[model samples]
Target: MSDWTPAEMPRLDDATVVVTGANSGLGYEGTREFARRGATVVMACRSVERAETAAAELRESTSATLELDVRECDLASLDSVETFADGLAADYDGVDVLCNNAGVMAIPRGETEDGFETQFGVNHLGHFALTGRLFPLLVAADGIDGDARVVTQSSGAHETGEMDFSDLNWERSYGKWKAYGRSKLANLLFAYELQRRLDAADDDLGVRSVACHPGYADTNLQLRTAAESGNPLLKLGMRAANAVLGQDAATGAEPMLYAATADVDGGAYVEPGGLMNMRGHPTVGRSNDASYDRDDARRLWEYSTEATSVEFPL
Candidate 1:
């Protein structure tokens, strides 16, 4: 799959893809490709109005028959996650793909509606609950010519992440980057554990849980972090770095698209195949050793299930 691009993706005429944070960045780029290739893409965003606006833009530019379903899903709130899943269940019989793409980068410490740290809550816990709630639908979609896939978007930062179960919420203190890394590490932990569980169940459920990362994409994620940090020098530095080293959203989204549609293995981590894993086409990249620790993943899973109350049917 060297130099693989969106042009290489297969047509998804009957697929249903739910992409969180679909209004911007890599999510938007992935949604555009899915819809253009004939999938019914659900734009799951925190703001319905903004999602509608992005949908409108996609419709005007994409295929006339593009089925872009706009839905509101605030990942910072557990109730919102349940509501979104409930609504989708009522309308769609199955989901071919679930793209856990919505996330927050390095930002000021805060709390979600559920009392968890903002980054961990939205980036890991929210997606954890959403995937658990949607497990039935994912199982139902299995064996329909192919398997249903869950693409959890992780990052290169996971290498530096250390799970602090004692202070999961950063109640004592918080380092923005550290918290972000932990959450991203949790993403991989959850993704791999889900696949392991599915295999152990052996119930013939063909739902593949994979992970991916966009290598230094020049998206609003960095800009928003810069603006939110409110440091002139930091903002200037981010802008200069983005201008010099970042790739476009389209290029950054290739790994996600590949993981979602290509013949990838379960628990595989897709990433850019360039030097330092920063800028290139989609490839099956590897995560740090900590990400593959079953003990940590199980502990995180138990804690998340207790916190979110969304149990997996596996």
Candidate 2:
């Protein structure tokens, strides 16, 4: 656990990693780095065609030693998540890293395939269920500095989140931006709570659940959200903002990459080491006060278990 940055990240010669939304944006950037460092990356994406195209593009630019495999796993569908987890467990020896990087932003209010709110369902519960389903593998992964890592990518937007347990599905009212905030906050809560459980578990398995946020870097997330939001102004504004103020997507992936490979402890929050956490190299940072509320985390965990029907290995 020495002081290290993304440039000092250790290579993963024989590690196997699973990254959702690996077809583009932060997920792809992280996957590219992992693959470049000689890890076998399983690209979990919703569309096989897009995943293949992205993988091929990476292969073209990446070192020939890199290995990338694409698999279909749509977070909006619990059934699909279950199938993906089952397939991963059967095919891989153990997962060294599980990057819950796939998520939607402030898109239009909608429901997932399972009738849950789109943001909460895909961004939080989907990853929640996926992580729970893969808990055994994470526990069994071969340890380098410690055990396997469950790196959940959260966001600064969490500062604005207030988890509304009563109307999680947004049956009463739906606010796209607020829902996005809630999802990011849930990512932090789940990561911290999972770490607590891991620390308390009696088993020798020493898995770590860590959280990280790429401070605002330019990614297609904003554009996608705006496009789907059906707000012409939002779409124009985001595109303009990204063009003018955003950093590169690869740079945006630095914090997450550091979190995945650094000598960090469970519950650590990695943020860009720069002014206002907007952009810079990956380094440790602070989360908002609401993120540390244990009572709320517990309640959220319970509700997540009931909602997803996938309980953690507590």
- Best-matching candidate per lDDT: 1
lDDT of 2 by residue, 218-314 (tens): 9999999888978899889999999888888988888888888987888999988776887788888789989988988999999989988998878
> How would you encode candidate 1's per-residue C-alpha lDDT over 1-314 as one tens digit per residue?
46799998888888899999999999999999998888999999999999999888888885567899999999999999999999999999999999999999999999999899999999999999999988888888842248999999999999879998999999999999999999999999999999999889957687999999999999989988988899988888898998999999999999999999998899999999987898999899899999999999999999999999999988
Cα lDDT for residue 119, candidate 1: 97
lDDT of 1 at 128: 98
Query: Cα lDDT of all candidates, in order?
Result: 0.92, 0.89
The local lDDT score (0 to 100) that residue 165 gets in candidate 1 is: 94
After superposing candidate 1 on the true structure, give the runs of residues whose Cα lies further than 4 Å from its correct spot: 142-145
Q: TM-score for every candidate vs. truth?
A: 0.98, 0.97
Error of 1 at 13 (Å): 0.6
lDDT of 2 at 172: 94
